[model samples]
Target: MNIHQVSVNYAPEQDRLLIRINGKEGGELRAWLTRRLALALLPVLNQSATAQMTKLAGPAAPAASLDEQRDQLLDTFQKEALLRTGDFKTPYEDRQGQPANAVLGPEPLLLTEVKVTLMSSGQLRLQMLEKLPGSDTVRNFQVMMDGQLTNGLLHLLHQSLNASQWLEPVAPANLTPAGSSEVPELAIEPAKPRYLN
Candidate 1:
């Protein structure tokens, strides 16, 4: 699908991340990311991003190291650069006067399986699946995202995860603000919705 916009939000009652993607062709896809799935997805997402960034950096990419801090610094730099070009300030446009053209169905799929692949074209392909509760039927959808969009999706997901507090809290000393140094931490509060375009 040609993605036009994406929104990920944390639903406290459901305790799951609701991911909504609006396609350029006016079709929408919605999925639910549960805590168990989110935990499993974190490592894969990180590995794919690291690999893609290293490939883009070519031979100039820094050598793999045991220094965790150094690796985090590099990741922070890349994320900041990507966020600069993102269009998060623009609110996600809602389909007006009628229900959205949902690709799978009107209900959001409870994603039971997700496959991540880095294609030869340098775009990441995500195949999401939902196994019907009492049937052999399974519904699936796929989306291709470039590096920047991948980073943006990851960013928004992280914000949702942070709000959900599904993981342990980090030490205050380890906390660092996102975006440029000039931008205060309050500017990126969890209450604000982030749109990936």
Candidate 2:
């Protein structure tokens, strides 16, 4: 479906991020992202965004040749450039007063699994699923996002996460690689991506 707008907000009471996607064709898809899922999903999102940035950079400039620091700087520059051009100031249009346009159901889907892959068309494909308890039921939904939309979604998720105070302890200041003076042997493993068919 063609997306019209995307919204991500933290719900303090639910302690989860509410993602609402309004399709240009007239339906809205809502999902709840819990802390556990967010922790696993954020890194994958970052990786995918970086991949897109590198693809846009083209074959002339290979990201592999650059040092870690330089590559990071380039990624930052690309992300900022794309983000600056996006129209994030416009408020997300929700189907509140009008007839319910929730395509899934009245309540948001409680996401149990998420998979993401960069498509051949240079768009990010996202698949979110909800597995019902005590039954063999798994409802799924899919959406494709361009680089700008991916970056926008990442920005929104980061803002909501900060507001939720869930990453305060592991904030940028506190993060240290293995064998550092501040923290030692920080057994952090690289994010393993899930394959999507």
Candidate 3:
């Protein structure tokens, strides 16, 4: 399970963190997180507008209600998460082969499993792998953030991964030869994957 590339981003207003992952096996997974663990990112916003937001929304501020404070907290996460820029990479689609105005007709990729691995590099990475029908190989990917990780943040990560639909299969409506119930043929065709544009 080799990871090709990982792109992580956060939107504090919505309290959402997104990890866009690309795998060598030919698919992608987008992990969208929405919760309070994002507040752990205060240190990252020390110099940003988010810091000002927090100060203005202090506990004693009559105008700063609980919801308003929550909004400011989200800003902090966004300010922090947006610091990382990543390019999505994959071996599946050759953009040069695609013609202009070509809409995607391929089936959706299935997210097989999600896991967390503590790397020797001192980063706690989140890994998600996808599987195609009939192929023993799975498209695996892993990504981690480099920063201060709070307990609430760690729990949020665990909660987000556990709540996702990654455990279910996202197979196509039309079954291919590999998924057919018919008897196997003497010669088998290679799996040609198609993905959205």
Candidate 4:
């Protein structure tokens, strides 16, 4: 099944999920849910504050407590920043134009891991690990031409694309036409550098 539409929005604190599909065949709701779940999980995997704290704290302190505190702080900051930015709807409303027959399905095709890297040039690189039925693969995407960092989530969405080259398709041929029912085993490793202008 060809992925005619893909929409992903993620905040570090509150969970925001949204997806829409359209085509001759009625779209699968699970596909959208999976994308949302994957996007939501991105912050956790990409979090740098936690990593920085770990490096600073070393292996002696109670790592668990520090991790918990880090999560709490991250959540609070994310929420507050989102509110201040005022870009997203407080209560997310599903966008109009989704097919009527779309069914809400369970979440399984979601990415097991997502790593986001912020570069000096204000671009955000996203590396996603999606697990299908048998094998896993890493997909790389980028958000570029960013505005001031305060825009937070909205800024990322504004510049979102799946490829380093602005006009190229995000997923390669091997990863294209995201399967509706078939699940494959996927793994994510450190991705190569993708420049954003």
Candidate 5:
């Protein structure tokens, strides 16, 4: 959809984000974006040794704490997305890959302007500037017969987006040694066909 305006306000104290749209509310857009952001930030967060150290020193430390933290982070992130939309019916999957269809109804109003702001407290704010339109921007919705089919498409999209970083020349070890002594010769076989008299 044609985005008319975009603004993002950050509220560092809240550790959340808000997103708004002006024209026709984009279905699953918020989830898609939150997933994107989480994917982008998760590695950095996980790699933060200082954060890990602090958590280790915190109260009630347990062996599963790290995993718990990851779950909490993801939950918080999705919650932030929900808050931004204000239309709660958005579908989101939990850490266990279970679908949580908490909210229901028509999608939120779409706006021409999409604003995203990350507050200092790590909160994100999204604002959408919408305008009335004669025609609907988003027209089609299809349910995939299999969940894996949808997942496969998402995986392909993710791979395409991340492919740049993983693109490297094949290592020498991965290639056949040019001067190696062993070489196999191709075998040729003749086939004969008989015609009935």
Candidate 6:
């Protein structure tokens, strides 16, 4: 979508960011971009950090202010999309003699939408919605983080959006009963997918 206008306002009490993106085609997207996600995108949108520094700067252009930061964020975001068309890697492994390769069931279902959320712990939570070949039935899968990620990896995430693919998801050992108020020490958990919806 061609973006026309954008805004980012911080809510200190809520520790949240209010982002509104207006597309040229009249579509509007609104979301509360979490602090971690904003932190993650800060470097990408910062002028001094990315390669766009030289080109985006012209003699008359003004330094990035609060308003421009939102524009920069939107500019940086177009390249980094949230939708998952059809890119997924099945688990694989190789051993000494047997060469144990995890069996990849069948061709993966077409992924309709994927949501990525940055947790306060500096980790990302990915929830994917995939559909069967010729039906409306869609199943959801999450790219589960097996362990705590290193600070370096987390830092790299600020630099690169594609770093998400490097993560792997696994099925939970035991399903938690629905409506369980207990946090599993892990965030396990869609709609079609929206910036905030």
Compared with the true structure, all predictions reach lDDT values of: 0.78, 0.82, 0.43, 0.40, 0.34, 0.39
Top TM-score model: 2
lDDT by residue for model 5 over 12-48, one digit each (tens)?
3432232222222223322222333534533442333
Candidates 4 and 5 compared by TM-score, better number: 4
> Ten consecutive residues with minimal summed lDDT in candidate 2?
95-104
> Which portions of model 2 miss their true places by more than 4 Å?
61-80, 96-103, 170-197
Angstrom error of the Cα, residue 19, model 1: value is 0.3
RMSD of 3: 18.5
Evaluated with lDDT, which candidate comes out highest?
A: 2
**In candidate 6, where is summed lDDT lowest over 10 consecutive residues?**
92-101
* C-alpha RMSD for every candidate: 16.0, 13.4, 18.5, 19.0, 20.5, 21.9
Where is model 3 more than 4 Å wrong at Cα?
Answer: 1-109, 148-197
Q: What TM-score goes with each of the models?
A: 0.69, 0.72, 0.26, 0.28, 0.19, 0.27
> In model 6, how large is the Cα lDDT of residue 18?
47
Looking at model 5, which ten-residue stretch has the lowest summed lDDT? 141-150
Instruction: Please give the lDDT score at residue 104 for candidate 5.
Output: 15
Q: For each candidate, how many residue pairs have backbone atoms clashing (under 3 Å)?
A: 0, 0, 1, 14, 45, 0
lDDT of 3 by residue, 108-161 (tens): 223444454444444445554556589976655455533333222343444444
Using TM-score, rank the candidates from best to worst: 2, 1, 4, 6, 3, 5
State the lDDT at 44 in candidate 2.
98
Residue 180's C-alpha lDDT in candidate 5?
A: 80
- What TM value does model 3 have? 0.26
Candidate 2 lDDT tens digits, 1-197: 79888999999989999998888877678889999999899999999988876675554444565586597777777755974366779999986333224356677889999999998777899999998789676767899998889988998999999998998786445566787766544566899999999
lDDT of candidate model 6 versus the reference: 0.39
lDDT of 1: 0.78
